[model samples]
Target: MNVATARLGARALNRALLSRQYLLRRLDLPEREVVEHLVGMHAQIPVGPYIGLWSRLAGYRPDRLSTMVTNRELVRTALMRSTIHLVTPDDCMTLRPLVQQVLDRDLYTNSSHAAVVKGLDLDEVVAAGLALLDEQPRTPADLGRALHERWPDRKPDTLAYAVRNLSALVQIPPRGTWGGTSRTIHASATTWLDRPVDPAPSVETMIRRYLAAFGPASVNDVQAWCGLTKLNEVVGRIRSSLRVYLDDNGKELFDVPEGELPDADAPAPPRYLPEFDNVLLSHANRERIIPDGLSFAEWCRRYGLMMTVRGGVLRGNLLIGGLLNGIWRIDKEKKSYTLVVEPFTKVSKKDLTALEKDGHALLEFAFPKAESRAVQVLPSR
Candidate 1:
């Protein structure tokens, strides 16, 4: 297949991603449909997906997602990149089998647990863990202690880690629900979802879905998103069916033929995104959303805030006009809620006004019954 010689600049690429992500405008779709469309959402942080969906969907409610969890319509599991994601039951079954190798690789190479589990019979350990989980969903510590009784020589947590890597376990509900305070609990996906892992999961189908949601992307981008390697061959097999383009850096990008590329000057409203949103983390190259030559630490420094290691990783990013501009967080005190924003660069009064307006709306959505709410945009140093 001949690759299209068209080139997409950063702004164009950013808009395409925003359009596909439903970030360009809030959609009035069903929550399950949106979840399935994005494939799944990054859900390492429990409230992250709720905030994410709230930003993308019109009239989104926290309880709707919580209800999905309770109904087993959606589950939180370790899938892409071996991090917990909120995905549909069908996707959990289909995608887990494809990424099993990534999980296994982590199991063996992980410095924390590898040595202790190196010579142990992993299959036996997995069976034991499953048996325990079958009886009831368990926390890692509880499961670990139970398995430790069977394998007295190894650390209990390592045995549990083996099961975590080898088996498809879903973090059960109330655990991932919005405002949920439950301890993390796990149960076997097969039993919990009442369905077997897809015996024949399709990497090509997965690739196609990636393109539909986040494409005009390179082979490296796909690997970065899914944590799978050597997909050049699979991409090669399906190249003829895809539309291709060159990014400004001359990297090859592939997309479904019908994928929309909005005008580079498209208007993008300011959005508040939760930490670990896939839109920020999915691509090998993030310059499309994160502006080039903008140092996040320096940006925070200019705003009189010291960026900590944890702060660096767990940031709620602010987007304006299709690019990252600031970081934000909601603070609670007594019966009040505050949305605090720190911009990376000095902004116009107009942008600040827009940000403040959206910030108040977000606060209302996140903490509806707070006695009071406020939006604070810290000044640049």
Candidate 2:
């Protein structure tokens, strides 16, 4: 494959990524279609996908996704990076098997549980765990206690962790439902989705999807996003079919032939992103979306404002003109919810006004039942 001499600057790559991620503009597509297009949403936090979809989809409703969860059309399961993701049943079946190596490596190298499970027969453990989950979905603690009956010498939680990493377990519903709180429960993905893992999962197809959603990226970027390694070989195999370009830094980038590259100056309205939004986390070098300068944490420290986490979810980010410029969080009180926006640097009045308007809309979507709603912008220090 002859490498093209075309070049793309950071802004050009940024626009292309934002356009692919639907951040440049909201789309009227169905939530399921959107979820599939982006591969999946990082869903360690139950509310993360709800807020993610709300920001990217037109007329998005939490109930629509909640209903999907209850119906088993969408599942929260361990997939990319061995982290829980909200994905369609089709993706779960296909992707879980494809990334099984990442999960296996994580189990053997994990500091907390690796030593305990060192000599045990992990295949036997996985089979037993799946049998138990097939009978009924169970929380990790409950599953651990049951597994302890067999591995009398190991820590119950450690045994459970082994099974979690070894098997394709899907966190059953009511667990991921919106406005609902429940213990994390697990069932075998085969049992939950009534589908076996894909016998022939495709790495090439996975790479193509990644590029479509978060691409014009380097090989390192693809590996970073999926927690896989040695993808350079896969990219090489498909190189001739890809459009090649060099970033300003001269790193080679790859994209699908039809991947859209919007103008560098395309208007990017203020977008409120959920905690762990894939757009921010999907790239190895996030300079395309997160502007170069002081890191976000450093900026927060300089301003004497801490980026807070509540119930395990970090504060959502504030994106202005296609770059991550600030952070926001919703503070819940007895009868009200307050949306707070804090910029890393001084923001112009025009940008602040736009942020406030969109911020209010987000407040309404996330906390419509609150007796009062307020949006506050902290002055840049």
Candidate 3:
């Protein structure tokens, strides 16, 4: 269990994340178990979660995720730093409380009027909203209008945040399931699942799970992933259960005593990560995975979307592997989706052949009507 060979390096970090995040290869574990292990899946785009899971799980049953949502085994809620996350119904019920302070801090820091809602009958509003949602899931707009009408004086945005962040809400099925295109909506966890929601699991339990999946990581990295800063106290309390290591610069990395730390020399493949992959976003010091200067959002803006020189709406496809190796796009024309790969690297004919095969396979699995793909070589600037 000792990560004795762990050196502080990017290759090591990438390989560790691959092994932990289930990205090195697909897994056959239950989807709910995978969701719990990974904390939660990024779900801004309805299909992105599916793409994320498909790339990770060997036995990816799209139907299971959908059914989990329908059955409330899995729930989507505005958790984790005010972004939507696909978490287990049980998890949403428990972790929502632990993250409340963090979510409140984010709201206060990011939004101006969070303090204004402090005096409102938060319990009553949440109760009303919960009662409304308990009967049927309602969209943000619908929930907000209802709450605002009931309160008759509160700001819609602030109320929306209160209801979403303060309550145990779940995004019901067809909103985030495969092949579904719908805006997010909220339902009470108990009502949605047809059972009472469970209580909070300790932060110690959370830290253990996080480190188990993404270990040899600093406490700060864990904080970034969980979006909290007050875990210093908890970290102090859990030292007995953790195994610690010193990085190259003599910084301590903590992990579970029973976790597997891979050899530092294991060969890593060129992994194609879906956007917002937690490995890229979950670390304060991401030098271990992405280079220091790599800003995924910036790269996406520059390469993924086409901007007008004179200023207009951005209208272009997302360019994958921007400035890293190659650029790729998903072309959805004529009711069929096709992946296009344009490698900026000097490709041997053999490499090009391999990329074409790999890219098409990726496309076909991701998009059903992906009839074919196009691969072209672009000169490196």
What's the distance in Å from true for residue 181, model 2? Answer: 1.4
Model 1 lDDT tens row, 1-381: 767679998889999999999999999999999999998999988888888999999888899999889899999999998899999999999999999989988888999988998789888999999999999999999999999998999998899888988999999978988777658899999999999999998999999999999988999999989999999999999999999999988989999988999988888888888866888778888788867723444444554655511242124877876777777877777888778787766777777888888888888888889899998898842
**lDDT on C-alpha atoms for all candidate structures:** 0.86, 0.85, 0.65
The CA lDDT at 210 in model 1 is 94
Taking the tens digit of each residue's C-alpha lDDT, what string does model 2 give over 81-171? 8899999999999998889899988988888887998889888888888889888899999999999999899999988888888888889
Error of 2 at 289 (Å): 1.4
Candidate number with greatest TM-score: 2
Clashing pairs in 3: 27-58
Across 22-45, the per-residue lDDT of candidate 3 in tens digits comes to 755567888888889888887765
TM-score of each: 0.94, 0.95, 0.84
Q: Distance (Å) between predicted and true CA of 274, model 2? A: 1.0
Model 3 ranges off by over 4 Å = 1-7, 59-61, 115-118, 293-295, 298-327, 342-354, 375-381
Return model 2's CA RMSD, one decimal. Answer: 2.2
